[model samples]
Target: MCSISFLVLILFSTNFFLFSLLMLIKDFCMFIEWEVVSFNSCSIVMTFLFDWMSLLFMSFVLLISSLVIYYSKEYMGGDVNINRFIMLVLMFVLSMMLLIISPNLISILLGWDGLGLVSYCLVIYFQNVKSYNAGMLTALSNRIGDVAFLLAIAWMLNYGSWNYIFYLETMKNSIEMEIIGGLIMLAAMTKSAQIPFSSWLPAAMAAPTPVSALVHSSTLVTAGIYLLIRFNILLCDSWMGQVLLLLSGLTMFMAGLGANFEYDLKKIIALSTLSQLGLMMSILSMGFYKLAFFHLLSHALFKALLFMCAGAIIHNMNNSQDIRLMGGLGIYMPLTSGCFNVANLALCGMPFLAGFYSKDLILEIVSLSYINMFSFFLYFFSTGLTVCYSFRLVYYSMTGELNCGSLNMLSDEGWIMLRGMSGLLIMSIIGGSMLSWLIFPTPYMICLPIYLKLLTLFVCISGGLLGYLISNVSLFYFNKSLNNYLVSYFSGSMWFMPYISTYGVINPPLVLGSVVYKSFDQGWSEFMGGQNLYNKLVEYSQLVYFLHNNNLKIYLLLFVLWITFLFSFFFLF
Candidate 1:
């Protein structure tokens, strides 16, 4: 299965890569659609928009999934249900592909539902309580988006068709279309784990490492960005677009802060993924769909490699996910460490790396735009937090003493694992420039002041410095005072979203359900519907059992009278 998938992706990537490079592909004048149902001016059709965006996104999904499968061969070799795992991954890939090609709302729902369900299945693949809890969280969080999508479909019903591709232009002036766009942004927010829905993505790290790489790279979270990009024109000129821009910027800032406080290895990267998702979303919300798309592609390449390297390290470290428990392993596992560093630097938007080109463009564009002071500062502050966490992470995992244990047991000769990381490592190094040239040959002509132009550099440097200083300093001496205590703690705790989600959102419903069960299910329902009928039936059965008259004389008289009545009836007839 893995080999066949690999071969298929090779062909797909080659074909689409050339097509994307051909410089001739244009938007379709009329997309090919096949009707599934038609009645009274209403029709549901399977419509595919095979433009550069869909093709490019599909290629990345396939690319990431294939690599994940190849890497999982070694990562999951000893597992008892390896086949099941592979099949689930394949299902996820298919769902993402379906989502990519869909131009109709109904078909998009079909794919959207598939992704949510399959992701739930994958998240719960492990037979542990943590996996089950995480799976429920992941599933329920995404279910919100699923419901929003359905509502958007219902709203689209006013037009008598679900093909949103043809209606993008018409939606601008229509209030109903604006509402639909708002609902879509909500759905996208949930799918992308922005703000209120942010807790699930980190909890989802309970799944196997391969799942993490694929999800963070392309398939699951990107679904939201992909959907919005297709609908970008409608969102560009709406008030909801401003709302989305603000929310996405806050989400990016929040996640970056959260990553600095997180201790779990996979969770840190998961938080980083959240941060990058925020970046993509904020850029899209700002009306730069192409830049967001470019970042999405470049981010996928390096982020997947990052997860693969983390997986390798975890495998070598006996599944210890706490970075605090690891140190100086760079001396032994140089290959894995090297890949980790490359991916991390790319994530930090280092020059010449995959993150640099797209990130720089996004910053430049945001600077040129006339957004408010709050959003402008939030964008750059989030960028600084990114570098802060990266440096802190490096200090914890790669530098200092050998904290976990002696280095005598360390080894990093996993060739297949390294082989998987190598593919993305090369891309992480070059994907940005290749995509920059291909996607935006001419580039935007932005003329910013020196301070505005140097904003990102300033943030990154200041962030790096603070990261090193605080990471080296011991926190035990700092008294818990009102000055920095709340700020420090809040930043690390993901601004308390996890608490609000678990207690505020999840707990109230559970409590209500229990109360309902006790009051209605066990009390009123059982007494009225079940117990009452049961008591009446029991009484009737008891009376019948006793109806023979407890005496012999009574039975004889009744028999004689019955015989006499029978003879009379016969004669009368």
Candidate 2:
């Protein structure tokens, strides 16, 4: 079943790629509308827009998803519910496709909600306490975005159509449109895991690695970026865009810093995904939507490869995910290590690789743009930090002395998994260049000072050096994290994001819920509603029973009083 799914996805991906190329060359777009219902003057229509951007993104998603599924056949071969896992993944892919094609807000909502619902199921697939918590965090965080989309849809109702594409140009300067744009930005922020919404991205690593590779790296998180790209016109010169710029910059910096302190392999990659997402959002907010899209596509290729490599290592390591316990893996798993390092280097924007094409262009553009010091520093420093953590990851996982038990054996003999990764490995090496040439028909003319041009290189080298030196151990070395526990804890714990997102966001509501339950459901509501009504009914029934129980003394007294009152009334008249 997995094999068949893989082939079908690959075939569709190839066709989509071809269609995208044709659309790009011809500069053509097709919109198909199917009317579902009509009332007097109103019509409900489902719309699908076929353009170069959507086609290209769909191709990338399908390609990555197919490979991930093929990889899963080996990674999850031992699991009893492997078939169910594949089905869930396929559903996720279908939802992403729906999202990619739909141009109408209502149709988009269907896809949007589908992504969130399916992702929650996938996240809790393992059915453990940790997985359940992660799933809840993932679901609730995404729910914010879902609500935002719904609001955007409702806001669009005033415009007389749900087809946002029809209004993008005319609504750019409208105040009402700005509200919709802000809601869309909020939606994108949550979906992409920017700022406060970011805690779920790392937590979602509780899911299977294949899901991480497919969902986190490309489809689910990138959905927001794509939506924003579609709605870019409304963001131009808007206050919401400015706010997004600041928030996304901070998000990028925060993810990089947090990844440096993290030890979990999947979590590290997850944070890296968040960092890249920030980069894309910041660029989009700056009105460079095409650049953002370019980075999104390029990032997806290598990031997926990175996750797959991490999965292979984890699989061989007997499900252990801590980087600290892994060492000298390059010797035993050379192929996996090679692919891992390639993906890592690509992530750091090494020249001529998939990431360099998009990342270097983005940096060059940022350097030339007029921006404040804070945004500028965030861009370059985050770039450096990306290199820092990536190299740090590479050092600990691949270069150090073997730290595992001597009796344990490790090999790169998972041929199926390797084959799956190999497909992405080739793409990671070439995908960026291919995407850049295809997406940007006209080259951007970037003019910048030599120092600024080299700034990225300088930070990358320094970051790489710092990353290696920081992780290197010597005879006299002491654990700095242990010595400065507070600092380490703060940084390592994602700057307390898990607490903020879970306990902090949840605690207040939970407390309110408890109070409501005690005061209302269990207290006044019960008393006034069911209990009070019951008591009154019971008292009335008792009186009636007493009156009918043949109580002769009470009846005689009542009759005598009535007769005396009547006689007194007659005499007075």
Candidate 3:
């Protein structure tokens, strides 16, 4: 089953990749519509758009998914439900593909909801408390996006069609269009984990590593970026663009900071994915849709490799994910370490690597664009923090003394896993340059001051040094985090974002529900409803029975009184 799945994915990926190239060369787009129903000059149609963008994205998603599934064979070897896991992953890929190819809002919603449901299942694959909580958070957070899509769909009815692509140019200043744009942005924000919606991404790491690689890299998170790219016209000249820019910038900074303070290896990587997502979103908001798409593709390559390497290490380390308990893994697992470091360098945008082609260009473009100092500062500082966390991760996991037991054994002996990493490893090395040349035939004209151009390099060096120094511990070193425990905890806990997303969102509603249960359901409602009505009916029935009871003495007394009253009335007249 695994072999057949892999072969089919590879076949489709190659075909799509070739077709995308052809479309790019010819500058052609094909829209296929099949009308499911028609009445009174109205038609319901399933529409597909075949263009360079959609085809290329589909190819990349399929390629990454195939490799991840291949890797999972070894990773999930001991699991009894391996077939179930594979099916879920395939379903996720299918949903993503549906989302990619469809130009209609109704179809997009179908794909959007599918992604959410399938992700929830994958997240809870282990059937544990953490997994369950993470799955719920993942599902609910995405439910927000799903609702946004639904609203956009309903609002698009004002335009008489669900095909938003056709109206992008004509509906520029319309209020309904603006509302739809805002709704799309809101949905994108949630799916991409920007700012307030950021908690769920890291929480979702409770899923298996292969799922992490697939979701964090290409399919789930990038779905929002792709949607925004498709609807870039709506956001280019709107207030929604500016709002997105601010929130995404903050998201970048927040994720980078959070990653630095994180100890869990997977969480740190998840945070890095969050940081990259912010980069894509912020750039997209700035109207550089192509650059955002470029970064999206490039990021998918290396991030997947990074996660797979982490998975290999964790698997051999008895399922331990804590970086503090790891060290000198490079000595035993040389191949995995080599691949891991390569991926890290790519993430840091090292020269000539996949990340360098997109990330470096993005930084240069941001420097050239007219933007606020706050945004400018965020772009550079986040870049630095990315390097900082990455270096810290490397120090804790690769460079120090072995922190585990003397009898511990670790090696890159999992050939299947290594094979999977190798495919992404090559892509991480060259995919950026390839994508850049293909996506942008005309180069961007970037003009910036020398100091500004050098800012990215400066931050990287400083961040790396800071990461190493902070992580370098001595035998008698004092723990400053304990002294400043509150600050440390807050910074380390993603600024309490998880608490805000979970408890803050849940507590008020729960309290209100309790109050309603007591004040209404149990209190006023009971009095005004069945019980009160029953008491009133009982009292009325008792009164009637008292007034008209069958008794001989009572009847005789009543008759005598009636006669006496009639005689007294006559005498008075």
Q: Which is the leading candidate under TM-score?
A: 2
**Candidate 3 per-residue lDDT over residues 245-295, each given as its tens digit:** 999999999999888878899999999999999999999999999999999
> What TM-scores do the predictions have?
0.91, 0.95, 0.92
Give the range of the ten consecutive residues with the poorest summed lDDT in model 2. 473-482
Q: Judged by lDDT relative to the true structure, which candidate is superior, 2 or 3?
A: 3
Q: Which digits, one per residue and each the tens of the lDDT, describe model 1 over residues 1-573? A: 666776787678768666655533463333577888999998756787777777777777777777788899899988988888989998898888888888888889888999999898888888799999899889989999989999999999999788888798865789898889989988999999998899899989988999999998898999999999999997786787888888889999988888877789999999999989999998898888999999999999999999999999899888899988888878989988999999999999999999999888898898999889999988899999989989989988898777776644667788888888888899899999998887886877889999999988999889988777767774336534235877878887788887887788767889999999999999999899898899999999987877755978778888999999999999999
Let me know the TM-score candidate 3 reaches against the reference structure: 0.92
Assess each prediction's global lDDT (C-alpha) against the native: 0.86, 0.91, 0.92
Residue 439 local lDDT, model 1? 84
Off by over 4 Å in 2: 37-43, 473-476, 545-569
